[model samples]
Target: MTEQYLGLPIGPADTAFGLMAEYDADQHLNKVSLIAGAYRDENGQPWVLPSVKEAKARLAQDQNHEYLGIAGSPALINVAQSLTFGSNMTKNLDKSIASIQTVSGTGANHMAAHFLARHLRPKRVYIPSPTWINHQTIWAGVGIHIEEYPYYSAETRGVDLEGMLSVFETTAEERDVVVLQACAHNPTGVDLTHEQWARVAEVMKRKKLYVLFDSAYQGFATGDVNGDAWSIRYFVEQLIFNGEPDHPGLCVAQSFSKNFGLYGERVGVLHLVVPRHLAAQGARSELLGLARAEYSNPPRYGASIVETVLGNEELKGQWLRDLDTMSSRIKSMRRELRRRLESKETPGDWSVLESQIGMFSYTALSQKQVTRLREEFHIYLLPSGRVSICGLNEKNVEYVASAFREVIGFNSN
Candidate 1:
């Protein structure tokens, strides 16, 4: 009886973090870590943006530690809103938008799941198959019925747009929740083209499905912040601004981690947009209630830093340069890795490396090859062969490419 009450099964460790621990323990000098989604400089070191450094300097003179409101810093939320939706849309949103500050991208996602699961109470939530690993776990934790729609195509090494839209047209119901990564899709860097996005939006609008846009990599994905946010803006214009009244609205979970290099700061905001005629005050209140009960308030310093940078014209310009620096480096590394791999006559198509945008690529390496790369070469990536392009630097790109060739060229199974 006591055993029954006290015993609970221990869950498996998180794959990325667990592997990170293993990599840390390995004593190999040339060991390379391609596991994390975080950015790394050409020297394979975590970088602090110049804009961030300046913001900290400004805050240091008058820095004060105090608990923020449950909704977080209004300044940060304002800038964040403008960042995600652009100025015109933010102005037009007016009363229909409900905004709140959360722990980070993860917290924003969890809050959205909790609020929607309780209030919207949809029949099922549709997530992309092989989405960010956390998507499934977040919705599942909220006790929502989860369904996976096709996302990527292994055959073409691109977004499986037809299959994804098919699922929406055939299976999804009105008011059902669908998760969409706004830009720089995690795991697989492939994103839907503008035409493909319009198609998906049309089907979603017709089906009256609720969209939860995960805007984790807005400015960070490409150098252009506005371009990165094209999908979300397009969706709002079609679904909310010009959409039906009865149609359930959408929400955005925005993170500043990758964009601002504030991963540890845990700064994020959640925006809930109701239908055209509906005011979001009630929904905003409910969100505040949930936020108050959970973590009380969001972090202060990080939000302050972000607000400082974005609010200032000079600092914001510097921040834009910072985005270019990170994105350009990732792009160059991708090209180099592809070039090296092809020059050695590695089997399979390596073009995907250059074609795919953002920090990650679906290398299409088998599970056996992944293991061999780790055990033999001490290079680490996810089991699904998703490698973080940020992990490849000037020093390690050749080594990583050579390892790939050795693993694929040998096939010692």
Candidate 2:
């Protein structure tokens, strides 16, 4: 009784954030950080996109601090909706799509969990085996029984699609919620092939599972926004317009954090889509109610920057080019790392380094090896051997690769 009433136990710190804090205090001149999903410039510094810089300059001439509406900026949402579904695609959606701007992707995801846990009330929610560190934390807060589906296979170094689909067919029930990464999957950068995506969609549509797409990486993945969003678009066409009206709906939690480099400004949108036969206005109103109870309103500065850039033709073109520049740099770094590792004859198959996409790579280095790298070599990366590829640049690429060879070099366990 005394223990119950006294005080709560201290919770564990978030692994990524904790490691980031440790990195900041290390003070080692040669220390390299492969933590944090945030983007870094060629000089290993935080980058403000050219489009964002122009938008900020525009705002300086006419700046004001004011609260956005409960649902956030209308212009921003419209542009966001277009970027996600494409103008032509959204035109076909018409009244079936309901959207609201949120604090960011985390907020969008949290809001989705809360709203779905209360209303949709699924019997279970299925998440990937290894995912963003916060996925389980967010769902646990909503009081839903969570299940895991096999996502990656360390043996094949690729997606375990058969294992994933088998679980869905065997254990997953109707109306169960399935969380999916829209593009550039986190931790492990493995994603499904087009045919693989179609297979999963077929199983999902047949089973009537509600899909919650986490669209944190859109244009950032392949520098082609339309190509990155193909899965979501395909699913909508197959499930909503083609499936039953009674089929549970799907939602997309879109983030501008990566694509627009608006990480700090916290700009995101959640779009809930119902079957073509149903009206979404009622659902939209309820979402507004949920938002009102939460942050009261979303941020203003980031939304303005994104809207200004996307709403204009020239600025939008510049933004597209910016995506290409960032993605190209990451890809180049990947190739260099893999080449250097192979040239030096480092241990395992280093080809995966080049194949994985986006900001992170899941180096097969074990936890013990990762610890040795941090302790002996002054390098920083997640214990799971995940590294932010953006952390590598021209100056330090060889040093980092050499460090890898020293730690797990040639035929050593």
Candidate 3:
């Protein structure tokens, strides 16, 4: 196999399907010049939040470079639990929750998937049809069967709630894990209302299904940390009342990359909420064993930054303000994009752009239209018609909107 595969060796300098295949010879990096992810700034440069800079300064001045434990800094973990579950959360304070530091949201997700696949032996894990691109890959990599439930409706450019409920009610009984985006639904940006979340909780409770909530954007979604956490908190409350003693499986994967402006830091936490009866020493031992085999232990720097910010009251307050600023910018972009598209009377409905909330908007553009935007207009976006709202700002919003209008309208003509 090696001989045959190696014989067809293509050097790294070539492009594999569009993604750069190799680093540049001069800079030891790829030559492609495109906004890599949804990240952006007014000047098209990366913008670090002022609050994060201050926190980093404080951390750097302190001479604590010691390695954190496998479970991570207890202070950070406690703050994380509080932020997600709320300050007055009865469940969190009860000490029944067990959390471990992870590389990031993706890493936390992968860890949860592996744990479920090995320990629970669930038949399959159900994910949203239009979930994050890496969701399928991460779960499938751990030997877990991946199944999709209805999510986006192309005609309406919104969620197919009825269709989603139908799938969950029927298929949940056979699945071991059901993955949910706690706040901001990625790519589409359509979130379930509080009432809708209650309905989902009901269905999951009746089915006795285990849930894994992936919260990548937390405060970055609505600019209010508590607001974004409502769904997960509600689910936790429901699980506490309904979960059986013999079986407890409610987990949360939280990311600080977006909210804390710590993307490269790769800091996040994976929390497993169990019934008080099951909170014995043995459970923690099992979790540690799983961590030891995976990545040995999570990194220290990112976790340290998180610990510092969350631990210090002043820094925590500043972080909240920064989150508000970032969220407001994304919200403004959404409005601007919608206004531009509407003023031009671009073909098709553009209401979804306004209705959807978070860092992304589902433009409802076709694959062909998206291609035209890239080839003809030099605008980059996912083929699924999703645009990162963060990619829009004062400088480029007009150009992006015009490009979108030209491609979409021209294609319709």
Best by TM-score: 1
Alpha carbon deviation, residue 399, candidate 1 (Å): 0.8
Models 1 onward score TM values of 0.98, 0.98, 0.90
Tens-digit lDDT string for candidate 1 (265-329)? 99999999999798899999999999999989999999999999999999999999999999999
User: If both were scored by lDDT, which would come out higher, candidate 1 or candidate 2?
Assistant: 1
- Superposed on all Cα atoms, model 2 deviates from the true structure by an RMSD in Å of 1.7
Q: Using lDDT as the measure, which candidate wins?
A: 1
How well does model 2 score by local distance difference test? 0.91
Candidate 1 clashes between residue pairs 3 or more apart in a chain or in different chains: none
> What is the per-residue lDDT of model 3 for residues 1-413, given as tens digits with 9 covering 90 to 100?
45757478755431222432211122421122232444556665577877778878877877766777777777778888888888778344376777888878888898888778877788888899899877898888988788898888877777788988898877666436889999889867899998889988887776778899999988888889989999988987787655555444688898998888788888888887776566635555666777788776777887778888888888889888888778887788888888998999888777777788887777778879977776666666666777777767777777787887888777872
- Residue-level lDDT of model 2, residues 1-413, one tens digit each, is 45644588668898889988988999889888999898899999988899889888888876667899999999999998898888987898989999999989999999899889999999999999899977899999999999999999999989999999999999999999999998889989888999999999999999999999999989898899899999998999899978888889899999999999889999999999988899999989999999998888889999999999999899999999999988999999999999999999887898998788899889998888888888877889999989999999999999989989998963265
Superposing all C-alpha atoms, what RMSD in Å does each candidate have to the true structure? Answer: 1.5, 1.7, 3.8
Candidate 3 Cα lDDT to native: 0.77
Worst 10 residues of 1 by lDDT: 1-10
